[model samples]
Target: MAERNNNEFEGKQKNIQILYEKFVILNRDLLNFGVSIEELKEICFKRRKTVHTVQGSQKNAQHSSFIVAVTVVCAVLISILLKIIFDSIIKNTLGTRCLLPNNYFIWEATRPETNCSMCEDVNSVLVFGNVTRDEFSNYAYSSRPMLVKGAALHWPAMKTFTYHFLKEIYQNVEGAYESIEEECQILTFKTEFRSLEDVFAMPESRVLLEEGEKPWYVGWSNCHPDVLAIMREHYTIPHFLPEDAEHAHMDYIFIGYQQGAVMHIDYISRLMWQAQLRGHKTWKLVPPPDCDHICSGISFRVDPGDIVLVDTRQWYHDTHIDAGEMSLTVSSEYG
Candidate 1:
């Protein structure tokens, strides 16, 4: 009975030892799985932070580019404004100092305030046939505006000066002439230099007379010798002008339509003569600044056949043309 009891105790001790070994193996496997889970969580957190940093850098770059573009645009506009203001100041200062003539005030004092009507008797303008050198000199010295009757009526130019004719001359003649590309305004005048061919080819619609728009005037003053030769065949120097003035060539060819020249003083030369060829023009003249208080403005009409002589330096003049057609004048300067 004692031996049987001892065998039972041994069997029970072996079973307890097997159970402890199995429990230790299971606890070691569970600890390794917990360490793997912690490593996976750390990798996921680092990836999220990297993505947030990249997105924040892209937004900052976009904001900086916008600021740079706005600054460049503002700088360009400021440069243009400064250039315009500087050019205007320089032009005005030079014109006042250099352009006013010497005897400008003396001539302005003697000008007669003749009523603007055409004279019925013989006292208005000297007829072209009766004009003498002495008479022309008297008017020139006094700085009076005169109308010479039948001055250019006999000239071949009066018959042949048409729009198409002038356009053909400008195109066929190959010479460098100053042509103005400008919008004529009463208050603000601006001109850009262009070639004669360019001016001829420009569309007429650019200068089409609109209701409140001023007429555009483009002219060529210093022409080529070839052009002068062609003009000389059609017209001759006035017989009444001084013998020394006979050498003077045609000075200007003013081309415009209605509302011809704006009211402004000519500061370049003393005396000028314009022969009306194609259309009628009306002139409005005011005395120089020194004589404005003593005399009032005068107005007169000049037809196609008449010649007008005036001291341009001493008067402020404006011109208007009859609508529906173009007005052309061939003019020259003489002393």
Candidate 2:
């Protein structure tokens, strides 16, 4: 029995030894697995850090691009605003200076003596009546101007010559007349064609006659021979003119209110006679440069039933009609 007990104890000790060896192997395998798991966790942490850094860099690049775009837009808008203001100021200053005649800066500097003592108060024009041909020749040769009373007072035109009468005669006639597009010197007068009916139909507002306003309508009657012939029947030739000049009938008719021709010298070869038939007109005449010593600028009013003979070629003249009514004057040119 004592021998059996000793063998059993040895067997039990072998079994215990086998169990201890299995525990040691299991512990080693667990340690190797734990090391592999730790390495994988470290790799995942580095990859996450790299992704975050790349996202931060991309976000910074996008923010920088947005800032640059906004700055460029603001610069373009400021430049356009300055250009508009400068152009407006230049247009107003130059346009106003051109319309004024007496106040023109360039004329004041260049022709300072134009309105000096020679343009002060002057005498009335010479008056004549029933002048003979010889008397007219003498006056013409001496370059004298005269106002003949009753030159057309007794003519049929005194009662019949009017805007309506003339319009009737030229209703269908194709004619050209002077028209102004604007109140500026560059486009003061231009020739336009229209029938007499169209002219009579123009609105009153378009025919400006007030001070500082440009006249819209003005013209000579020489454009149409038929119209000229009709005008000759109303007023007879002055007896003062020679027989050769009798056939030289009236060639111009001025029809307007409160305004007349601009200051200018006529370059035509013949002397001119204007017969006032309807309204009052004041004439302002300036002599030629050579005649300035003997004559100053002269101003006189011509009433209805009066005729004025002037050497328009040798004088600078302008006219102004009274404001109440439209004025009518028939004029002729003769040597």
Compared with the true structure, model 1 gives a TM-score of 0.55
- lDDT for each of the candidates? 0.58, 0.58
Q: TM-score of each candidate?
A: 0.55, 0.53
Worst 10 residues of 1 by lDDT: 180-189
**Candidate 1: clashing residue pairs, number:** 0
Local accuracy of candidate 1 as per-residue lDDT tens digits, 41-90: 33222221111123557664553453344334334444544454555444
- Residue 323 C-alpha lDDT in model 2: 72
* Candidate 2 structure, TM-score to reference: 0.53
Q: Against the hidden true structure, what lDDT does model 1 obtain?
A: 0.58
List CA RMSD, all candidates: 31.9, 35.7
Task: Give residue 268's lDDT in candidate 1 (0 to 100).
Answer: 47
- Supply candidate 2's per-residue lDDT for 143: 49
Clashing pairs in 1: none
Error of 1 at 74 (Å): 31
